[model samples]
Target: MKDKTNEISMKKKIKNKAFSLMAKKGLKDISMREIAEACGVTKPVLYYYFKDKEDLCYSLIVEKSVVSNENLKKFAASGASFEEILVFIFSEYMQDISHKDVFPFVIHVSSYLLSNPDLGKRFEVVKEQNFAVISGILEKEYKKGTITKKGKEMALQLIFANLAHLILNSCEHAIKFSPSYPKDMARAILKAIDYREK
Candidate 1:
């Protein structure tokens, strides 16, 4: 039991260190040795926890995605209205981008995934699972005639594109947005999709 606990702790430490390093340096520039040294562990310790750099990177992506999907599921199950849920998700994303580590980490991971087709395909599967949860929520709105099927599809694209824009402009250009940005963006998206309240 103690060994397992220690193992979990060590793995968390290694991941956190690696995430920070990769965010700053990009995946191709970072090495397992550097991650091990950052974590104050030997190279062998990192290898014991992760088979290789790709394994560690993939694990990081999965860990974050799983937590995000779980939260989306919980929020969707909470019976919030579609507008409320959109605001909540946008707000959460805004908060995440505000963190120093998140934006760069997302960029690093995205660039890495683009270059690694196999890994990108695996990521797409995880992404689809998340989309399904959001789609389920959107389906409720569709059934009630608040949104058309085309509107539902556009809503998904608009929401994610908006988030990507926010992160990119905010991080790369150091742009700042008001506290009400999330709610404003949510309303804009709904308006763009011609959503009608039932």
Candidate 2:
């Protein structure tokens, strides 16, 4: 039992350390040696846990994305109304982007991967899986006549477009050293949801 607990704890520590370093240093600048130093371990140990930097980064991104998707799905599963679902998603996204230091890096890496044919495929797969979670909720809302789109394709596009715009705006503000205005932006997103609002 103690051994299992120690193993779990050590794994968490390594993940946390790697994520911190990735956030501060960016993917291109981060090295296994740096992650090891941050974790108070050595490069060989990191390699033992992860094959390479790309492997570590891919794992981290997928892990975080899946976890976020799970939480969003749980919120959607709560028998909430469409408006409530929209608000919940916006609030949760704002909270995640603002608080998690690694998210900015994750977004950056995703964008980069999406442009390269080799890595783009993997990121795209991960993206589709994550998007399906939100799209599924949107599909339910659309079926209930709560949203404009009646199909998953349209719903997915709109959701992704809105979310991508909001995230990019927030990132730009952060880069400028300006205070985050997620609530204001989130409200704008809420207002833009349907033809009636337009």
Candidate 3:
């Protein structure tokens, strides 16, 4: 039991240190040796916890996405209106990206994904899982003829694009919008996609 506890502790330490380094230097720039040194561990010890840089990064992203998807599921099950749920999602995201540590790490990971499409492909499964929750809700509306196929696609794009904009501005500490920004963004997306509130 003690050995297992120590192993878990060490892995957590390694992940935290690696996240800090990667946030500042990015994935390609930092290495396992550097991550090990930052965690005050040897290269072999680091390897024992993670197979490679990509594995470590993927682990981190999966951890975050799991929690994210859970929240999405909960919101979807909350019996709220679709528009209300969309606004809530945006509001939650704004709160998330406002965190200094989280914002930089997100930016770093996003940059790495954009620059390496092949590597990015590995994350598509997780991305699709996250999107599936939203798409499921949208499909209900589509089936009811409440929204068109194009409208569903446009809604997803608008929400994600606005989220990217929020993250970028938050990273630069240039967020000048009012506290109602989330509601405003949600309204704009619904308007753009011609979504009818049911």
* Model 1 per-residue lDDT tens digits across residues 1-198: 999999999999988988889899988789999999999999998999998887898788789778877887788788877788898888877777777888888888899988988878977877787788778888888998999999999998988897778888767548887888888988998998899998
TM-score preference between candidates 1 and 3, better one? 1
Candidate 3: TM-score? Answer: 0.87
Q: Which stretches of candidate 1 lie over 4 Å from their true place?
A: none
Q: Candidate 2 residues 1-198, lDDT tens each?
A: 998898778777988887877777777778888888888988887887899887888887788788888887888788765555666666666666675573577665765576667976766778888777877876666666655763445546655776676567666455432233344443454456542321
In terms of lDDT, which candidate is strongest? 1
Report the Cα lDDT for residue 60, model 3. 85
Task: Tell me model 3's lDDT, rounded to 2 decimals.
Answer: 0.84
Best by TM-score: 1
Task: Sort the candidates on TM-score, descending order.
Answer: 1, 3, 2
**CA RMSD of all predictions:** 1.7, 3.9, 2.1
Task: Give per-residue CA lDDT, model 3, range 60-179, as digits (tens).
Answer: 888878988788778878887777888888888888876677777877888888999998999998889878877888887788676889999988788778878887888668867578
Better of 2 and 3 by TM-score: 3
User: How far off is residue 98 in model 1, in Å?
Assistant: 1.1
